[model samples]
Target: MARVELYVSADVEADGPIPGPYSMLSFGLAVCGTFDGTRFTAPDPSERTFYAELKPISGDFDPQALEVSGLDRERLLREGRDPAEAMRAAAAWVKTVADGALPVLVAYPLAYDWMWLYWYWVRFTSRSPFGHSRHLDIKTFYAARAGAMAARSTKRQMPAALLSARPHTHNALDDAVEQAELFQNLFRWGG
Candidate 1:
């Protein structure tokens, strides 16, 4: 049997730099593409996705970070889904979309997003759908694949052909879709 890798483009909006001390206000995931050891299939960004806004686990949050997401912190506190429930739902969604393939989380500059997601998964669900280390950083992937300096691998430094048409609206789902487009572009770049 061949291995199947389901590339999931994920994004997160957080209230602070780290989890536990803050919270993941929201998160989104889009199944960008899949490779079944021989061939690749790139899906439209609007297809097969998940999004959630979670209640805070802590009282601390950075005002500026919260502002960036443009989400009402007070409203989230009042109405957001419980973290455990949200994480469980998210995990189930991932499993359903993945359809037995290994789902690998992909994100531009993945560290921050990965931190919030992995922490939430462990803290709430006891394990992650992507496990502890199955993540791909688009920035690092581009740096190595395009021969650019890792420190200078921002989207501005990328080729226009590889950029997504979608705007970066700071909404977790929008960004996830945008990054999904970017990931598809990169995945089909040389083949």
Candidate 2:
């Protein structure tokens, strides 16, 4: 099989989890280590891009999360694109970059990236844009490697010290970079 380059979808949420019936505040995304991109755009029709962002549906922002993402709510309201635009852009970007089969690796699989994205799409666009139903859950992958595997939830993650990992920006792009680094580290550690 051809080597499958990496792609990630990320989100920097406020306080609410999936079924957010709560809120998602802001989001940013980037694809790295393959296309040599400074932004999320895919350079070729066959290449792929990873995406992320924060979406505040209900207006409830988590103080800590807000502090972490550093996205200005007012700025988002004034400048941010609508959910439809974002999704369409994301799908178009992916069409340009993705070369894999299906079911890509996302940090938290169902909840964080996939579930939240699906929710946003179904709620706002009335359709789902994802090509697959599965995602590689990093937390569980790390845990299984560490013999402590559990279900995936944003609230959970492999202990940072386990991989001597440093802090993550929690910003969408930064977090995606960190997750890729963590996955690579796990691979090197024989996980």
Candidate 3:
């Protein structure tokens, strides 16, 4: 028998363009809901969530990227959680929340966040909770569902009804929760 697909919205704040040379300053995950093939059940996104800030793996960083997250690299070097411990904890959290269901990562655009998280997971934990390919790009989801060009399916272009009320605070956890609501709205949309 097929199990439910638990959608987890992910958001990452980084200090540079990519991982390794830079660092994923922080990241967050929020449980959006579940889909048992036919029905989508929306959940309270704030209830099941994970957040972590990690020490920089490399000293190199982009000033503009740092500006976006507003996380101090110097402070993080001193106070951030160890990457291995954090990623392992995050993986465990995903498993616990997923229970018997399959966890499918849901992210806006998908590529950027996935790149950082997947790299960190493999680097630090040897694997990822969402596996290698079970993920969804909300932008593409909207583009297909709305019958619009892929490039034209940006959040600014989405129906106002589909947008979440929460502000995009750039904090990974806040953005993750906000993204969860947007995912719920997009999943239940008919067209």
Q: Residue 30 CA error for candidate 2 (Å)?
A: 4.7
Tell me how far the alpha carbon of residue 8 in candidate 2 is from the true structure, in angstroms, after superposition.
2.3
Report lDDT per candidate. 0.92, 0.53, 0.95
Candidates' RMSD to native: 1.1, 6.6, 0.6
Top candidate by lDDT: 3
lDDT of 2 by residue, 1-191 (tens): 43444445454455555545555555444443332223222222112334444345566655675676676776666666676677667655554545552324456443576666667667666755454453566666666677763753233455544442535666665565555555545544544
Better of 2 and 3 by lDDT: 3
Positional deviation of 2 in candidate 1, in angstroms? 3.5
Please, what is the TM-score per model? Answer: 0.97, 0.66, 0.99
Candidate 2 regions exceeding 4 Å error are: 1-9, 18-22, 29-55, 108-110, 126-129, 149-166
Task: Give the number of the best model, judged by TM-score.
Answer: 3
Native-referenced Cα lDDT, model 1:
0.92
Q: Which pairs clash inside model 3?
A: none
Please provide, for model 3 over 69-131, each residue's C-alpha lDDT reduced to its tens digit, 9 standing for 90 to 100: 999999999999999999999999999999989999999979999999999999999999999
Candidate 3 ranges beyond 4 A from true positions: none
